[model samples]
Target chain A: MTFQVILVLFALFAITRTSRQYRKRKVSLYWFLLWTGLWALVIGIALYPTTADAIARFVGVERGADLALYLAVVLLAYLVFRLFVRQEETERSITQVVRQIAVQHPSKPDETH
Target chain B: MKTIALIPAYNEESRIAASVRDARSFVDGVVVVDDCSVDRTGEVARAAGAIVLRHVINRGQGAALQTATEYALDALNADALVHFDADGQMVAREIPMMLEPILSGEADVVLGSRFLGRATNMPFTRRMANRLARLFTLAISGIALTDTHNGFRALSRKAARELTVTLDRMAHASQILDLVKVRRLRYVERPVTITYSEETLAKSPSSFRAFGIVKDILKDKFFTRI
Candidate 1:
C-alpha cells in the first residue's frame, strides 16, 4: 500500500513538472506524451504488481522488479547521450555566433570616423 | 595588389603591440583578431595602428583567424592575405619572401616551413613534435608538409575566400592542408625564420598542444558530421 501511494505521488509530481515545461515551450508534445506514457505505465505496474510479473515472464525476465530496473537504466543512458549531443551542438552554434559578432564590429580606434 | 596581414591573437598584450608595429612596416594594413583576451590586446593593437576585432567569447586561434580572414576579404577588400602570429616569434623580414610568390602570380597560397629556413631558440621537443605532426598530417591528408603548424603564411584573396576554417582550435592548421588538397590551390613552401621566446614557449607547450591537436583532428574526422 505504501509503495502504491509513493508511486501515485511520483506520477502526480512528474505530470505537474512536465506540464509546466510544456507550457513554457521547453518540451514538445511528443516528449510530453512519452513522459506521460512512462509514468502511467509505472503507476499501473506499481498498483498491480502481479500484472507486471506476467508481462515480465512474457519478456523472459524472472522478476518484474528486475525488468523495471533494466528499462530504467537503459532509458537514463539514452537520455544522457542525447543531452551530450545537444550540448555539443549548442556550443558549436555559440562559437559561430561569436565569430560573426567579432567580425561585424571591429574594435578599431578609427571606427568613430 | 593591396596586401593585408591578419594576426590571430589571444592574451599577448605584451607582445601584440610590437608585432603589430613590426608587421605594419611591411603590409598595407594589419588586422588583429583579439580572441576574447583578458588583457588589453585590442587597445594595444589598435594603438599600434592595427585594425582590431574582438571576439565576444574566448574562441580558439582558429576562430580568431577565421574572423580576421573574413574581415580582410569582405571589409578591407584585401587583394592578398598574410597570416601571422601575435606572439612576437615570427620575423617581419621574411614577409617579403612569403609574399613574392603571391605577388608574381606564381602561387595562390604560400606556407612558411621552419625546417626549410631557420629556427632560432626552437626547443628540441618542439622539433620532434613537428616531425610527428608532419607524418600524421601526411598519413591523414596525403600531403607531406615540412612544417604543418607554421602560422606565417600568405594567401591570395581567392584562396582566402575559398578555404573554410570551421574548427575553433589548433586542428584548423591540418584543416587548412585538407583545403589545399581538396581545392587544388596552387601552394608553395617558402623558407621563413621562427624565433621561439621564453614567453611564446610558455604560452604554447609542445607535448600538451600535440595531444590536443590529435584529439581535435580525430574528432573532426570521425565524430563531426561535416
Candidate 2:
C-alpha cells in the first residue's frame, strides 16, 4: 500500500512537470506523448505489481525485480550514450564557431616582449 | 611561394616566444593560435613577431591547429603550411627538412617520424603508445605509418586545402591519417628528431588515456560522416 502511495505521488509529480513544460512550449507533442506513455506504464506497474511478474514470465525471467533492474540498466546506458554523442556534437560546433572568430579577428601584434 | 609556419600553443608562455622566433627564421611567416591560454602566450607570441590568433574558449591543440591552418590559407594566402609544436619538443632546425618535399612538389604532405630519426628521452610508455596507435591506424585507415601522433608535419597548399580536421582533441592525429587515406593525398614520411623533456611528458596524456582516445576515434569513425 505504501509503495502504491509513493508511486502515485511520483506519477502525479511527473504529470505536473510534463504539463508545465508543454504549456511553456519547451517540449514538443511527440516528446510529451512519449513521456506520458512511459509514465502510464509506471502507473500501471505501480497499481498492479503482479503485472511485472507476468512480464517477467513472458520473457522467461524468474523475478520481476530482476527484469525491472535489467530494463533500467539498458535505458540508462542508451541515455548515457546519446548524451555523449550530443556533447560531442555541441563541442564540435563550438570549436567551429570559435575557430572562425579567431581567424577573422586576430589580435594586434604586441610591440614589446 | 609564401610558406607560413603554424604553431598551436596553450599555456606555453615561457617557450612560445622562442618557438615563434625560431620558426620565423625558416618560413616566410609565423602564425600562432593561442587556444585561450591563461598565461600570456598571445602577448609573448605577438611580441616575438608572430601573427597571433586567439580563441575565446579553450579548445584543444587540434582545434587550434585547424584555426592556424585556415588563417594561413585564407589570410596569408600561403603556398605551404608547417605544423610545429609549441612546447619546444620539436627542433626548429629540422623545419626546412620537413618542408623540402612539400616545397619541391615531391609530396603533397610530409609527416615527421621520430622512430625513423631520433628521440632523446622518450618515455617507455609513450613509445609503446605510439606503436599501438600505429597498429590501430593500420587496422582502421590502412595507412601503415611509423609514427601516428607526431605533431611535426608539412603540407602543400593543395593538401592543406583538401584535408579537413573535425576532431577537436588528441584523437585528431588519428583523424588526419583517415583524411590522408580518404583524400588520396601523396604523403611521405620524413625523419625528424624530437627532444622529450619533463615538461612535454607532463603535458602528454597518460597511458590510461589511450583507451579514451581510441574510443573517441571509433566513435568518430562509426558515427560522424566526417
The global C-alpha lDDT for each of the candidates, from Candidate 1 onward, is 0.88, 0.89
Q: Tell how far residue B27 is off in model 1, in angstroms.
A: 1.4
Best by DockQ: 2
Best by TM-score: 2
After superposition, the stretches of candidate 2 with alpha carbons farther than 4 Å from their true spots are A108-113
Per residue, candidate 1 scores C-alpha lDDT tens digits across A27-108 of: 9999999998899898889889999999899999999988999999999998976776677678689888987888778777
TM per candidate comes to: 0.85, 0.93
Model 2's A-chain: what TM-score? 0.89
Worst 10 residues of 2 chain B by lDDT: B217-226
TM-score, first chain, each model:
0.84, 0.89
Q: Could you give the DockQ of candidate 2? A: 0.62
What is candidate 2's TM-score against the reference?
0.93
